[model samples]
Target: MEKQTPPEQDTIFDEAELLGDGYDKHVRRARNTIFVVASVQFVFGLVLGFSGPEESKWISIGIMSIVAGIFAGLGFWASKKPYQAILIALILFCGLILLDVIFDPASIFKGIILKIFIIVYLIMGVNNARQTLRIKQALGKE
Candidate 1:
């Protein structure tokens, strides 16, 4: 272990090293993906607010803004807690998608391509974070 990793550096993220090497790549990707999700959600909320029924306009916008805020917060948290943040983002995104499908079966066909891409990217990010953490733990790093 000593030969595999430098001895001087210690980090607060459960001893996860943040400096050097390419270990931060997955975390960065996860964080960026989260921010992108938030941005898209917010924009969708805006678009829906104007296009949807008048009665639900404000409500829909409010709910989406809140969801977007949650993602944004997780993105910021990823800098300090990559594993937890990424995991939560993955679960939340999946859960929301599931809920949408459950509530509206036809919604699945609405944006099939975009939905697939987002799910794939989030899954990849989650997998990357998991592997990175495992490797760091093995090396006595992250």
Candidate 2:
């Protein structure tokens, strides 16, 4: 009798748990995105910090830097912990915008810088929101 060929080897992709770690890929992706984005922003902030603020814009830069520092800190935390990272990022984004409004400055240049932060903040917001939704969904909470 001809011996039957051994059964075809199962590939790793054929496994039931290819998803890996049961962790939400979307959340992981979003966290990684923020980590990269925030790291870039942190570097950018340093560059901007060196440029002398406009005569009347020192206060504005100080305020914006404070806000940015907070965001960077939160982004750092999120980079380390995806679950809480999204929430903190969201809070940091909103807080930056609020600070921008609360401390309006006269210099257009400073305002534009604040606006850049707003834009970056928005990007972070979107990523964080997505991560938050993914985490919640994965947990079957909502």
Candidate 3:
């Protein structure tokens, strides 16, 4: 009779399985955070658009409100597929920052600071989603 050797345990797989639940929770929290922030931005944009004087600035505010609505919609979709949402959000944020810089150079410093904070927050959410997905893939390989 021939003797068979058992396959060696993979440390990576073991680690992933151990952390699988935690990763799921992390992803959930990140998704929720994104949703909340997006919702807030949408509401704020709406208020700004409507509460402002009926001047030319209202047109700009309306455009901003539209962008915010798109961001909120993206956030809702991101709950299912986070990575894509993160990319789109980052792109939108960058475009907004560029427009602000071009139109209101005097507030460049303030805008840059706010953008940095938002970018960091978005990156953290992206990282959580990515790590959770990676762990899922690793465990699936087992």
Candidate 4:
């Protein structure tokens, strides 16, 4: 009688299948993109804050700059904790959108198209960050 070879067991979480080197590259690109975007936001806020015509406007711009700086910092911190950073970014984005709607309801209709584009962009960024976190976890690097 010929000896029979045993079949290999199939594992649910195969490291090779679950984690690809491409994910690492993707995560790096996403992190850099987010950081650049946040930095630009902070810089623009700073310019607006400083170049305002009136003291009241300056104060508002200053507050906006501070918030933008915070988001930029969060983007940098995403390298270490992507999920937390993405959550904070999303929360900040939502808050800003709410404030915009509350303060300028009339302008909202005029800029509805622009606002929609921004909303979509923010959603994609959040998704990218979330995917980075998942990839890290799956790769056992988290």
Q: Which candidate has the highest lDDT of all? A: 1
User: Residue-wise lDDT of candidate 4 within 1-68, one digit each (tens)?
Assistant: 99999675445556556645655454455455556556656776777667776666777677767776
Local distance difference test, per candidate? 0.81, 0.54, 0.67, 0.65
Instruction: Give the per-residue lDDT of model 3 (tens digit) for 1-142.
Output: 8999978765535664565665556555555555655665667666876787768557857676677678777778877777678667767777777877899887568746655767776767677767766665676742
Clashing pairs in 4: none
Q: Score every model by TM-score.
A: 0.76, 0.42, 0.63, 0.61
Give the candidate number with the greatest TM-score. Answer: 1
Model 2 Cα lDDT, one tens digit per residue, 1-142: 9989967643533232433433444545445545554655565555665575666355545655565566566656654555566666655655655665677644335556655654564455456555555655655543
Q: On TM-score, who's better, 2 or 3?
A: 3
Pick by lDDT: 2 or 3, better one? 3
Candidate 3 wrong stretches, greater than 4 Å: 1-33, 36-40, 43-47, 50-58, 111-113, 134-142
* Residue 90 lDDT in candidate 2: 56
**Model 2, position 107: C-alpha lDDT score:** 38
Which segments of candidate 1 are over 4 A away from where they belong?
Answer: 1-23, 139-142
